[model samples]
Target: MRHATTSDGVRIAYQIEGQGPPLVLLSGQANDHHWWDGVRNDFHSAHSTLTLDYRGTGESDKPDQPYSTAGFAQDVIAVLDELGIDRADIYGTSMGGRVAQHLAARYPDRVGALVLGCTSPGGTHGIERDNEVRKSLAQPQPAARQALLELMYTPAWLATHQGPYNTLGDPDMPAYAKRRHLAASNQHDAWDILPDIAAPTLVLHGTDDRFNPAANAPLLAQRIPFASMHLIPGARHAYFEEFRAIASPLALDFLATARQR
Candidate 1:
C-alpha cells in the first residue's frame, strides 16, 4: 500500500494495479480499498485502477475530528496529486459516490469521466431508506452481518448462494471511526452541487435497491447535466458485486467512451 498526506496532516492509504489511464475506485461507507476486490481485475484490463482507504477505515489515519464527503474528496485529491496524476476517471459506490460528487464539483479539472452506483444525494431532496432498512443497519455485531447481507442482496440471491456472505464492511475498523464514518455519510448533502460536476457522468443502481433506494439514481442523473442512468434488474444495494457481470462492463464502456470523446 502507498500513502498520501492530506493538507490536514491525515495519512491516506491507497493501492494501484494494472496499467493505462488512471481510474480511481472509491468504496462505500466504512469500507476500505478491498471493497473493489471482486471487480478490480475486470477494470484493470483496461485502466490503471487506484483504490484508497477512506480516512476512517483501512490503513489510513483515523483522527478524532468529524468527517464529511467533501473532506473525503480532498483525501482523493491528495492521492492524485501525490502520484502526479492531473486527472482520472472515478468510479464510486454508495457513500463514495457522494464523495465523488464533491470531487467532480469542487475539483472539476482533476476528474475526467465519472460513475456513481447505488448512492444517494442525501439531505432533504434525496430518497431515504425505509425505516426497517435503517433499523437493520442499526443492529449490533453478528446480527448486523445478517441484516446487512439481507439488505445488500436479494432474497433469491441469498437463497441460492448460501454459505458465507458478509457485508458489514471493514471488520477491523475501530468503533469510534465507524461511528464517525456513519455520521459523515448521514450528514452528506450534495444535492446543491450536482450540477456543478463537470465530468461526463453515469449513474447506476439496482432496481430493487432498498439501502439507498433506486429512486435516487434518477434524481442524480437528472440533476447532473447530461448524466445517464441505468438500473440493474432485481439487484439490491451491492449491485456492483452481486451483479458485477453487468455493472462493471457498463462502467468500463462508459469510461472508455467518455475518454474517446
Candidate 2:
C-alpha cells in the first residue's frame, strides 16, 4: 500500500520487503510490482527489497500520456528519494533493464550497483522480437501464456511455472497503459547513455532468450565501462523468476560485493 508521487504529480505504488542494503526491483513491460513475486524474496533475506508498480500498472495511477524510459527512471529516483535512500543497488528485467540503464546513467550518484537482466540497449544496434514471437504474444491469455512460457523458460522448467502451477503476478494494467508501456519500450535507447554509467553493473542474460536475444548481453557489457556479462545456458527470458534458485543467488553475490566505480 506504499506510494510515492513523481515530480509530475503521478502517484506510483510500491512494495517493500527485507532489511539491509536497499535493492530496488524494476520489472519489464506490461507487468506490475507483483511481477517480481516469484523471485523478489530471494533477495529479501540479505537486502531491503523495493518493488514498484509503474505509473501505468498495478495500483499506480495511469496517465494517458506517452511513457518514456527516462520518465520511468525518474520515477525510480522519486521512490528512493521518498524513502530517504541516498544510493542503492538497482535490478531490472527486460524493459526495466532499459530503464535501469538510464537511471544509472542519468543519476549516477543514486545507484551503487546495477543488474540488467534479459534486456537490450535499444537503438538501431538492438535486436527485435521475431515475427513469430510477436504473433504469440497477441494470443488470448490461455494460448498466450503457453506461447510465452516457451520463450520464457526451458522446456523442462515449463511445467513448474505454467497453468495451475503458475506463480506470476496478475498485472492489472489496462490496454491503454499497455500501449503506452510498449511505446516507451519501443523508443528506449540506452546505447549512448550506457558509457556514462558509473555504478558497477552486471548484465545477465539467458542463452535461449528469443524476446531480446542473448547476443545483446555482450553488447551491454562492452558498452558500459564498468559492466560484466553472464550468460546462463539452457535458460530463457524469464530466468530471474523461473530459475531464481540460480539467477537470484548470482545477482545477490554481485550486488553484495561487486565493486563500484
Candidate 3:
C-alpha cells in the first residue's frame, strides 16, 4: 500500500492491483479497503484497481472530529494525484457512493465514470434507513454487527454462506472511528448536487436492502443525466459480496461503455 497526504495534512492509505485502465474503489462507512475484497480482483483482470481506506478507517488517520463526504472526495483525488493518474472510473459503495457523487460533480476532470451501490442521494427525497437499522448501526457492537449481517444479507444467502458473517466477530475499525465514520455518513447529502454530476453513472442496488432501500435507485437514475439502475432480486446492502459474479460483470460492462464514450 502507498500513502498520500490530503490538504488537511492527513495521510490516506491506498493499494493497487492488476494492469490496465485505472479504476478506483471506495468503501462504505466504517469499512476499509477490504470492502472490495469480494470483486476487486475480478475487475482487476481488465482494469488496474485502486482501493483506499477512508480517513477514519483501515490504515489511515482517525481524527477525533467530524467528517464529511465532501472531504472524502478530496482524499480520493490525493490518491489519484499521487499515482500520477489523470482520470479514472470510480466504484463507490454505500457512503463511498456519496463521495463518488461529489467526485463526479465537483471534480469532473478527475472522474470519467461512476458506479454507486447501495447508496442514497440524501435530503428528504432520498430513501433513508429505518429506525432499527439506525440504532443498530449507531455503534459497531457485536450484537449490532449480527443485526447488520441480517439486514445486509438475505436468509437464503446466509444459510448457504456464513463464513464471512461468522468471522466478523470483532469490529474492524475502532469504536471511536466507527462513530466518526457513521457521523459523516449520516450527514452525507448529494440530493441537489446529483444532477450536476456529468459522468456516466451506474447505480446497483439490492431489492431487499433494509439499510438503504432499493427505491433510491430509480431516484438516482432519474436525477443523474447519464445514469442507469439495476436491482438484485432478494439481495441486501452487501449485494456485491453476495452477487459478486453478476454485479462485477455488470459494473465492468458499465465502465467499459463509459470508456468508449
Candidate 4:
C-alpha cells in the first residue's frame, strides 16, 4: 500500500499490481479498494490494475469536511502523479463512475479509455432510484445489510452462492465521513461535460441493477461521444463481480483496441 497526499492534505491509500498498461479501478460509495478484490485479478494479465480507498474509506485519512466527486478525481490524479502514470484506462463503478466522468471530462489527456458501470449521469437528467430502494437503505443495521445484498445480487446468484460479498463498505468509517461520501456522490452532475471526454468509452451495467438502475447506462453511453454500452443479463449492481467472465474481458478488449487506435 502507498499513500498520495491530496491538495487538501488528505492521504489517499492505493495499491497497484500485475503488469501491462495501467488500469485504475474505482470503487462504489463508502467502499475501499477491497470492493474490487474479487475481480481485480481478472484484469491483471492484460493491465496493471490500481485500486484506491477514497478519502472516507480504508486506510485513507478522513477529515471532517465536505467532499465532492471533483475532489475525488483530484485524489485519483494525485495518486497517478505520485506513481508517475501519464495515462490509464479507467474503470469506475457506482459512485466511482461518477468520479470517472469528472476525471475523463476534466483530464482527457490523462485517460486512455473509460469504463463506467452501474452509475448515473446525475442532476435532473439522471434517473433516481425508487423510494422503496431508498427506504430499504434507510433501515437500521442487519436489515439494511440484507437489503444491500439483495439489491447488489440477483436472487438466483444469491441462492447459488453464499458470500460475504464485501457489500457493506467501510465498517470503520465514521458516520460523518460516510455522510460526506454520500453528499459528494449525490452532488455529482456531469451531464454538461460528458461530451468533453476524449477517450474511447464503454458504459456497463446489469440489466437488473436496482441500486443505480440500468436505464442510466444508455444515457451515459449516449452522452459520451463514441461511447458503447453493454448490459450483462440478469446481473445486479455488482455486475463486474457477478459477471466478471463477460465484463472484465470486454473492458480489456476495449482498452486494448483503444490503445491500438
Name the top lDDT candidate. Answer: 4
Stretches of model 2 off by over 4 angstroms after superposition: 162-171, 259-261
Better of 1 and 3 by lDDT: 1
Q: Estimate, for each residue in 1-261, the C-alpha lDDT of model 1 and write its tens digit.
A: 999999999999999999999999999999898888877899988999999999988999989889999999999999999999999999999998999999999999999999999998899999998889878877897787788888888887788887444345898899999889999999999998999987899999999898889999999999999699999999998899889899999999999899999
The parts of candidate 3 lying over 4 Å away from their true place are 135-141, 165-172
Task: Estimate the TM-score of every prediction.
Answer: 0.96, 0.94, 0.93, 0.98
Model 4 alpha-carbon drift over 4 Å, by segment: none
| Every model: Cα RMSD to truth | 1.4, 1.9, 2.1, 0.9
lDDT of 3 by residue, 79-166 (tens): 9999999999999988889889899999998888899999989878888878878888666677777787788777787889856542
Q: How close is candidate 2 to the true structure, as a TM-score?
A: 0.94
Q: Rank by lDDT, highest first.
A: 4, 1, 2, 3
> What are the clashing pairs of model 1?
none
lDDT of each: 0.91, 0.86, 0.85, 0.92
What is the alpha-carbon lDDT of model 1 when measured against the actual structure?
0.91
Q: How many backbone clashes does candidate 3 have?
A: 0
Residues 128-156 of candidate 4 have per-residue lDDT tens digits of: 99999999989998899889999998888
Model 4 TM-score is: 0.98
The lDDT of model 2 is 0.86
* Model 1, total clashes: 0
**Candidate 2 RMSD computed on C-alpha atoms after optimal superposition onto the true structure:** 1.9
